[model samples]
Target: MSEEANQIVQINSSEFSWNKKDGVFHFDGAPALLFWDNAFKIFLSTIMEISGPDASNAVFETTGFRMGLLVNDYYQNRFTIEEVIKKYSEIYSSAGWGNVTITSLYKY
Candidate 1:
């Protein structure tokens, strides 16, 4: 595995917290929610059931693009560009989303 993949494999428990009274979980000081893969599947399925495959896919794609932009703005404001690039994948992986490797990065 690549170094990035290896980095993703390591999990630091101290980076996570739970507020039992509020039923909230936090990672790296940001509030988080857990959703099983099955729940995500059901979410897409429900959208497909209502809107059909193409529409559902489009909806998700566009929403994902916009959400990514918002996340980018948040990071850009708080971190240097280099820091954002370095920490982006690790942050998402730490959140239990999945590992992301930037194979060929190009800076403008």
Candidate 2:
């Protein structure tokens, strides 16, 4: 949302859903997932609404990473970035969307 912040904010859509029973999140076709249990409550934008595991799919382009470089800030506030990616990839394991894929990530 801010060039200086390097945060590309996006809105949630139908692809993002909630699994109330499991307390996990599914986004953009990703599987039910959990991260830090409850670090992210709600990620809001004009078009998107995402939570926890679903939040991982929201990263369209470089956000804080880019902002950090711009401001000469090298530290990643959250260490789970890599872990989150791994988990997402793991859930995707050889399973294709089978034609139901988001052509582009929403960013504003």
Candidate 3:
């Protein structure tokens, strides 16, 4: 990543808070959880095994779309459109979703 991209994706540790007693984590005061990718893959594969690929795809797509809308609403309140565009990768990366590179952006 370029230096600028690195800066853009930098996350501050202070944004995350842990509540040991409650067994919960929060990022920017919003509840969050961290899980290994392998574990998630196993869970997904199990779903596929039970439901089949077609059903699992529909299930995943519906869940993802709803979750994405919620995420967009959350960020929309906290950031301007431009800020959201620039910080999209940073938000996901900080949430442990993996690095995202916006190689190209287009506006309609």
Candidate 4:
């Protein structure tokens, strides 16, 4: 891992919130579903850019699977904080955000 990869990427957390009590995530003061459309649109654009038009769907599916793995491992105590960071770094690197680090993870 490079030094640049250790820096966290900044996002506006104010756009999203989570209710720990109910285990629910909200976006823009509403349920996450309301925000998914726009979020997916942005994500699809990046997917197309990275994987090209034809492979975007497959790439998206694979990416989702990898993310699930990371989350599952985290919840199952299969990875330490450093391990989780490394795994996420690999994911972001593959997704064309190699130089960026993620500062937070929201349930939504």
Candidate 5:
């Protein structure tokens, strides 16, 4: 397999720790994996400010699986594994303003 063959990858996540402010979901664990979109990024930031340093994230696995489902469910749809990977890579890269990272993509 060549690198060019696979296009799309998967959403990447960083380590996030669970935090607790007087016993709350303040991401105080240890920064296991954090993923955020527009809404999520805001949420993460807010939480961080409110609580403390508990969680860290880069991106999500699937911003939304609806599209992927559609393609997969389509009877006529037939994408090679590599093709699907490519598609993910394109989206991940395209999501610049979104500011997302590339994670492991599914082989199938």
Candidate 6:
């Protein structure tokens, strides 16, 4: 990973408490609702190994589906995947991960 990718990974990892044994992410020390943006980042990290033409599509679909179950469903559809992507793009950019994008999340 590049330094920026490493930084993103670090930021994302610090946001949650992980249960390595169970492969779970917890908020406030509990398995509570994760924000949609956070869920998107987590799912995006998993597909870092993916590449080629459909990479963005893969990231979009996978992140959307996971967010639907982990965050959106619990909040009753307050936001969309597009919104999450746009919001996080700015966040990642400002955090020195400017290369990170909805499309680039999986492509790299």
Q: Candidate 6 — which pairs collide?
A: none
**Per-residue lDDT of model 4, residues 2-107, tens digit only:** 4333323324322445555555654434454333556868978987998787798788788899978865754456556665665665544533444566787655
Higher-ranked by TM-score: 2 or 3: 3
When 1 and 2 are scored with TM-score, the better candidate is 1
RMSD of 2: 17.5
- TM-score of every candidate relative to the true structure: 0.72, 0.19, 0.77, 0.31, 0.28, 0.26
**In candidate 3, what are the lDDT values of residues 47-82, reduced to their tens digit?**
999999899999999999999898778777888867
- Each model's lDDT comes to 0.71, 0.39, 0.73, 0.58, 0.43, 0.52
Q: Stretches of candidate 2 above 4 Å error?
A: 1-14, 32-108
**Candidate 6: how large is its RMSD?**
12.8
Shift in Å, residue 67, candidate 3: 1.0
How far residue 47's Cα lies from its native spot in candidate 5, in Å, is 1.4
Considering summed lDDT, which 10 consecutive residues are worst modelled in model 2? Answer: 5-14
| Candidate 5, lDDT over the whole model | 0.43
| 21: Cα error in model 4, Å | 28
User: Which one wins on lDDT?
Assistant: 3
* Among all candidates shown, the one with the greatest TM-score: 3
Each model's number of backbone clashes? Answer: 0, 6, 0, 1, 27, 0
**In angstroms, how far off is 97's CA in candidate 6?**
12
Off by over 4 Å in 3: 1-10, 103-108
User: Could you tell me which residue pairs clash in candidate 2?
Assistant: 1-7, 11-47, 11-48, 12-47, 12-48, 12-49
